[model samples]
Target: MSQAPAVLRGQVVDAETHQPIPNAQVGVADNRLGTSTNDDGRFVLAIPPAYQQARLEVALLGYRKHSQALPPLPGPELRIELRISPAALGEVQVTASVVGIVREAVARIPRNYPVRPTQLTGFYRESDNEPDGRPRYLVEGLLTVFKPGYQQRGDDGEIRIQQSRKVDLRPAGQLVRIDWAGGPFITQYGDFVHRRAQFIDLKHLRDYDYRLAPGSSYAGRPVFVVVFGPRAGNRRADFAGQMYIDQDTYAFLGAEWHYTAAGLGRSPNRADSRSLRVAYQPYAGRWHLKTVWWQTRARLPIGPPLNYFGEFLTTAIDTAQAARPDYVERAQYHDVFLRNAVAYDSAFWQGTTTLLPPESLRKALLDQQRQQRADSLFRPTTPSAAAGTAPGPAEPTQQPDNPLGRFFSRFRYGASVGAWPLAVARAELAVAYAPAGYRFGAQTTALITDQALTGWSRVEYQYELTRELTVTLATQYVFRQFSGRGWAAGLSYQHNLRPRHRPLYGRVGLAYTCQTVGRQLGTFTNPDDGLRVAGTNLGADRLSLRLQTQADALQPTLGLGLELSHKFELVADASYLLPLRTRTQLEIAEESGFFLTRSSATVDLPAADVSLRVNGQPGSTLPWRQQHWLLSVGLLYRLR
Candidate 1:
């Protein structure tokens, strides 16, 4: 049996002014356990006994990260203070020496980054600005990124769409076309840490010449500024830019880069260029991408000049809980297409605050609604009519679908509402309405939240008994692409428990569930379009359970569950929230379960198969087992 874990408590503060730093990251260097400081810069982390000898790390943006061996035993009240980093890199601002510093920083990536899955919830915005600085098209979105351990690479990190909004204000009769692919994902693709290594990797360093210069201070920290570009004799289309690394941890802090005309895919004769700026901040002992700004311009031979500018800002980071490896099935971000996903009403917007003001957001949405309405009303019914009438605003030409288009289009919708989550490979829809605190709706289980729709068709009903209590019943049909499709139903009663502190609350509930698993559970390479299939889990299931929890915005939630069965399961999860500002709160949660008796099986995905090793033996099968184990970090937002 595993020994109980030890608890470490402390407060992270600024050294000079001695103020608490809210949302500062605190963790043990070698374990999956970690947590962030609350508003008071205080934190409590459950450290596994295995990492008793490891160091504890504390970090916040603009400040030097702090690390020290854990106390021999949980000690007295601890206060970890971080100094504001000096904004200079000593006298080593020389060229040859600067390259060495860059090399060292790159080498330290593995040691400084999180080895476990980490989730970050941030705000992202993209805009097309007119020459006068007015935004022609604006989009804002909340992002939940499941960062793979530092050992991963590329867009390997899973990105989930939380909530988003967009507004297009092109002149009624004119259209401004800018590629969405390059709008924001450029930042993801341009990740200086895990990817975009060509800028710093030793193997790729030969392509560019390096220079060193003094850089301005960032978040009050001094940095070593290094500039590099394609060698004079080597004129390949490439990026030329300056990069800054914190002098202390050797972490990449910020960069100013420009794409050459050739790099923009324009001919030498065409005047084209794009300037981009990217910045990072130290969070919880790791550097995170914080902001990206860029502007692109071109002189097209056939049409009016093209100009576009965009910016992406990250608002929060939740390091307390890591996200499930499959937090979001990556393909869904593409399959359903963000543009055609979900739509929310003004209530949603009113309930959430973003980097932009509520009034500004309202105007943007209103303008888009008006423009869409006008286009629909003015659109000619026939091609002949379109030609006969004076030309209306030039319709946006349909371009070949590209990954970038789908990514940006995602900013237009809300999280999926119906059939998208379950079927894992099929499209689904849902319809519902509620009146007087009661609701009736039909939705597919397959496509509910972030995963593929479960294809479990269901009709649901809910009745509010009071402000804090409600009762719900749902009957669902499970349809598998292969077999094992059946029916299941559940009824649950829950009561919300509130503490005097407004931001804190909890829930208690009771539920009964019944399910039937067909004899042949089919597995397909691609549920939507796979040609191969196999049978798997087979059984009938029933359960009765009771649950209780108490939590609030600023405190970690504590929950307990009891399953009423011969062999039952026990589950527990905890979370804490940190308010970054007026309407934004970052939440992180983790869950683990213990089952006296559980089902086990091995499933294969010919299309998405993964290899594994068991007890030091290489294995080709993924054993599906139920017992007690740690869950990935979950990030949630309380934005109003």
Candidate 2:
């Protein structure tokens, strides 16, 4: 048959420096046949049995280029030299998946590998030759998100728009602030999304372990090849593809990630094997993504897209009282300050950023209830309906895990729409009930601890006008599974909070039903309408005041709330909602006076962009609660 080839020889060099790149990429491509270069950047591979003409490739990250072809018979003591180069030039080659270059040149991997490979770094080592030519750089770009209606997790993963600030580098390797004032960025910051300054030089990765993977190469030079494995805290993460570094100067031609998070038009993922290819131009000293084609599969969390489901607060001001009445409103604050999307209001309590008191509110309300049971002294922190301080007196029947609000809670005004139909959108949950089934004179429906799960909810828009709670009109649209389409409208008054924490604050709304309750034909049908109008019965009008509060004691998890509702007809109101929990309620009216009623325990699947709540009817139509009760638990990740 065939005998193993004899003399084996190869040239080795630095993958970056390109000049006699050395000291790496020894033996065979895999665990097959391989050898490293000597001090002279050269290696001899005495072919083992059964191999043909082959050469060894010397490689390393942020170093000189690697030469693999072999010349005639180069005896042992092969010569090989490695040229060191700067890391983080205009381009950086890497992989989205936890990268691992297992050769002796590289080591291990970490956890939570990157989901997307949009991360880039730049290394600036004063090129003593010419300096001023690299001051102002330009990076034109385009980013497309997943289809508007992808089946997988979307809305929360929409394509994002950004214009990031360019960072400046000092050869001394010192921390330097960027020109923050001149970003003129196209993107805004928020709890849900935003961008960062582009400049984390790779120079640091040089003496580090891992080496490049086999079938991978760099798109640009000095920045040519990059080697990496899982970092410290990146296990259990998905691995993408390898990045190609340029064989010349350290610069970025672009990236080649295994998974692409962006898409074209509304097309779902066309391929499971994602790849992100980019086109960049070198500006002053920076490189930007000019054109990028990001591809990935559907049903995955991949984006920074047009997110439309966060929440905010609003207030109604009575300008008649203040000399300078500002109908001021706040939109997407998550872009600037995450977790601080509290809607703006017009009342005294508006504009103040406050942390949720997970414990105090509950204690205060419970203490009041004990006093009422003692038949002892009477306390009046606030008047019942006197209009002075809303938190008049401690409520005797304060609810634990309640959503209707403690004693007194008032809200400013401004959910109303101006130019756009959306005044404020958010993720929420809610529950409804009928006690005595009447709006005005009916008794509220809420029992001990009972709740139902509805997905994220929406709150309607309101505007500030007067000083008192009497604003001309308060309109709101709530997204629910109502008759016909899955939405309802509501209109109501401006409610306020007395500064109590238990179920912090809520809203009081009213809805004039236009049509009667109908059915939802979907396989997973939820409640379409609560009112199945009896024949000849005029459509019913609803009235409610719901309260929902966050429990700081359980930060980063768990949400709680309560609701109190009434229908004008008295016998048509019910209220009690707990997600993945039980709901017990009781209804009362001017006629029946009071009575225990419907009770239901169910699971609540969170919704997309609306706040869930139990509040006064909105739009004179069925509406969503202003405060969200749609609590949920899950993991969060970005697709950038």
Candidate 3:
């Protein structure tokens, strides 16, 4: 058995002002294990037995780095006071031009950042809120990120969600919804240095005007502050921001940027405002991304504006053991981190150091949980049926308490009407149940036209790869009004293009279907005499021809869904089926009809052995070779 790890609790504050320092980095010297102080400037760190003798270190921007021997395990909380560095106390002089300093910093990017692969462990949190600052929901996760160093171009990196939990704070009857896309990956994409953002890109230097601002400090070192914005008459430039560079080394330390009026004008969604901040920490002779904070606000079509906020805090870094994540572990760029998150683990969260949410959000979350508990208390309970007693009055079924059970118990049913673009009008009804990451469903469709009627019943299984992607397998039975039937099997994949938090979402799908269909052809009539012709007639006008064929097709589909409320959604889908290959078989049938009785005879014939003509002209042997298009619109109701 392994020994229990030692725990250290501490608070970091300024030596001169005695004020708490938020976002301070605390760790063991030369070790990969670390944590950051919360908003209260408090931190808790766990040290393994092997590292108990190592020194504890604390560092924050504009302060002097402090280190001391580890105190006894289980001791009282320690208070650490860090003094302001002399350089940051207005003691350093800068004589270089602002533009030159920024240029040198951009040029040294490859040398300042890691040149090889590196891994970082961090905490990610995102929140959705109303315009009035009421919290709607919050998602938190532990993430492991792997990235190719700055020397490599066009490589963004990979993220693996280790664990996560979501808390919904919306009150009962709240119908509005809002969410962010790309989750923690948004922070990765926001890394200005890694992405070579326009502001820092050397090629765009002439488009911006830069001026030296007041001096600042970061990571216990003085930094040169440079403020920049788009130059006059530069309509293409859309950002205004400040950059912090280390005074001695000229290495880029941090940046804060926001969209200017010109930028907001170019936004496709007409965002009211957007801003982001990124900071880097120096360790082991290289700089690593330390923190990222982003916020955005946009007006809704029918209500107040929605606000989104997200942050990522790196707690540990490892360069020696850095490697790419396996395919199953790597998160897709469109994946919603909360949907792909692992179940919450209380013990793990208790031991982890994470940024705490604001007091208002925490209180809202608590109230939500309390309401859930209060509601649960009034749920009616039923007696066991195996007690050899008569059944009691019917009552509403209770929701399952376990996560897996609850998921399986949830269901959705929908009905829709559509058309095949002048070919056939159709109505469809569908139902589905989800047990975990996968779902099982069934749908029945009816098609009608002036000349024919058709019905299709299908059973489908779908597995969710991410919140926005799903793979489907289905088998279907098709029946026509003419006493004809067929069987089909297909595989398809669907990807949602819109964020889940939006009221409107769009998706695209691709499928391959193989099917065989048999249908009876109406009796042939001679055009010249308007007389019926029989093949092997038991009686005139009673002879029927049947056609059976195999058709394989590739289908592409586009769909949209609009949330009507918490439990209902309106959906529409359109699909085009392109036939790939077809094989035909023909048969001749003769029927004898009597009062309340009928008899039929069928003779099979090869397509090559039979000849068909229409309007005195030869007809193609492959009759079911045409492509088809289908469209449908429906309403879905969720039941749980």
Candidate numbers sorted by lDDT from highest down: 3, 1, 2
Model 2, span 83-120: residue lDDT tens: 65455243334221112222221210011111222222
Worst 10 residues of 2 by lDDT: 565-574
RMSD, model 1, all Cα superposed?
25.7
Superposition-based RMSD of candidate 3 using all C-alpha atoms, in angstroms: 21.3
Tally clashing residue pairs in candidate 1. 31
Candidate 1 vs candidate 2, lDDT winner: 1
Candidate 3's C-alpha runs over 4 A off are: 1-96, 171-176, 265-270, 354-640
Residues 263-343 of candidate 1: C-alpha lDDT, one tens digit per residue: 666434244777878777678777777776666776655455556655556656667657453422331322222242334
Using alpha carbons, what is the TM-score of model 2? 0.24
TM-score of 1: 0.40
Give the range of the ten consecutive residues with the poorest summed lDDT in model 3: 429-438
